[model samples]
Target: MLDDITGKVMVLENHNGQQLEQQPQQQQALQTPKSGVRRSTRISRPLERYSPSLYYLLLTDSGEPECYEEAVQVETRKKWEQAMKEEMDSLAHNQTWDLVRFPAGKTTLQNKCVYRLKEEYGGRKRYKARLVVKGFAQKKG
Candidate 1:
């Protein structure tokens, strides 16, 4: 029945007439011609200049508050306050710090609230506020 088959057929056998499994053929690597010339696949085109108005339309400023006083004075003051409250609640829930008295002769570090406008899916904006300590003020012990 095997003799009726056409094309190249690999056959492996042992002394006991048991057929051995054949390994798969390895693929050949693509080789360039002897001239060593490589064909350019990309087409070169003239660069198009864009107008400044297009950039202004695409990249709108976030207009987030830079400081706490500015945050409270902005039109989105309620949103910024809510965000700050949420941040404080999260820090308290995580037990990030404990209330303690200031150490004598030790300078206290200053903290500031940073605000940002986070854009969500479908053009929705979310207010985000983070409390950051001024670590640079700390002196090396």
Candidate 2:
């Protein structure tokens, strides 16, 4: 018997000391998609472009060439949730914003630092930024 198990060696019994022969006509056909419509297949590799047109652009600042080579900037992606949570925790621990019901016709009488936090709604967190006033300042105007 022919085995296709990975990383393991098979021990075969050679009774009568005969060699095994494989027949090509006993092969099974691979399964294919239905003939009526074409099923889409996702491409699994990067695209390659060849023989493309090349143009040299000379970037100058008021008749002076900045450099002979072009500048390149590469950016990597990041997860903002962890950083945002840390910032929110620091703001809350420092008592940056006090949750209170301020009476109508009354405004904060102090210089403040704006604090922000994220609130989740409908499977997404909406950020709420608030201006927190200092307690030691008198109202102006």
Candidate 3:
């Protein structure tokens, strides 16, 4: 499916897996505007050039880092570390937790860092690293 200014273009397949093209936009009849309603028309503007890199980036999946050491590049690793530090700073500012002595029989659960590549509404790529508790070990309150 592809979306153009006219409308969405849908491709269909037959029982035998033969591809079929839907009727062209020109053949579709136009509907008359309703009575007592004013329709606003938009001025046509030049189309923007398509970016192949942006298209490929959007289509491909960027996998998360399995471990802290899994970050391949120095810059990527730095970004992860910066994200972690920012999170820690926020947690500290909010007083999310307090440092305390560990109970003798209890074990402290270790946290894991997860990486996600996000695209902003303005088409900017963001590298986000989130720290998550290994919650499988946590019991119901």
What TM-scores do the predictions have? 0.56, 0.22, 0.49
* Runs with alpha carbons beyond 4 Å of true place in candidate 3: 1-63, 72-75, 139-141
Q: What is the C-alpha RMSD of each candidate to the true structure, in Å?
A: 15.0, 23.6, 25.7
Clashes of 1: 0
Candidate 3: global Cα-lDDT? 0.73
Task: Estimate, for each residue in 24-114, the C-alpha lDDT of model 3 and write its tens digit.
Answer: 5565678887788677798866554466776566544455566677655545777677776887788889998999988898777789877
Candidate 2 on 1-141: residue-level lDDT in tens?
A: 445677554455458866555433576888886777676697766444322322122222222212212111111112233333555688889997789999998876664323233457766644332434466676555
| Residue range with the least summed lDDT across 10 consecutive positions in model 3 | 55-64
* Candidate 1, superposed: residue stretches over 4 Å from native: 1-61
Best by lDDT: 1
> Distance (Å) between predicted and true CA of 126, model 2?
23
Q: What is the C-alpha lDDT of each candidate?
A: 0.84, 0.45, 0.73
Candidate 2 ranges beyond 4 A from true positions: 1-78, 107-141
- In candidate 1, how many Å is residue 115 off? 0.5
